[model samples]
Target: MRSRPVLVYDGDCAFCSSCVAFVERRIRPRCDTTPWQFADLAALGVVQQRAAYEVLWVTPDGRVRGGAQAVARLLLNAGGVWAVPGALLTLPPLRWIAHGLYRLVADHRDRMPGGTPACALPAARPPGPPGGS
Candidate 1:
């Protein structure tokens, strides 16, 4: 297993890329930040469908956190001054609100700064018969 955690995000979304860049530059997290498009999801035990929905934080011990939780984990891992805010954000009321806000931003990311129409998620596949079509 690797020594550092992995921050997995969407490569097709420009807004996501910008956010990743900001974290890399400002937070300087002690982890490897990678786009899902280039990540070996199977090795990470991450599903493609879930990854399409939100950013993921995969711990070295094989733990996985998504969305707001993932963001908090990343910030916490950065250590020092950032740890306080990260800890606060993961608490009660703020945690609930943070999750909601994370969902809102993720759902409408195509309209956010640095995002384009192409940033929208692809249509999900419809369920089929148990065995095969």
Candidate 2:
């Protein structure tokens, strides 16, 4: 019976925290922001691995959106002028582009302003051979 959505992010990442601060001060989206480390992932319907991988937007109705889509949801919740770009980000070609851009930024977050080595996500492991090799 939660009323507002929850925005889950990496608290260990200074860059991510700074971005959240900016959103709170400027965009002011209608959601509760919590770092994944401090949030109850199971209750939010988010897995720990996925929460570690990207930002998440969990709605009151239990719909979960991640990464760029999460950003779009934030903007949409903010309403007013921000809603225009938010709606566009959910559309076709723009959605494709936004996904790519989000990945790029996520992959290099450690290099972004206010970021530290802690902001770097663990390197993705390649698929292993059969039999746990």
Give per-residue CA lDDT, model 1, range 27-84, as digits (tens).
9999999999999998898888778888999999889999999999998999999898
The C-alpha local distance difference test score for the whole of candidate 1 amounts to 0.89
The lowest-lDDT stretch of 10 consecutive residues in candidate 2 is 123-132
lDDT tens readout by residue for model 2, 39-107: 999999888778888999999999999999999999999999999999999999999999999988887
| Pairs in steric clash, model 2 | none
Compute the lDDT of residue 9 as modeled in candidate 2: 99
In order, what lDDT does every prediction score? 0.89, 0.92
Segments in model 1 whose C-alpha atoms lie over 4 Å from true places: 123-133
Candidate 1 lDDT at 77 equals 96
Query: Which candidate number has the best TM-score?
Result: 2
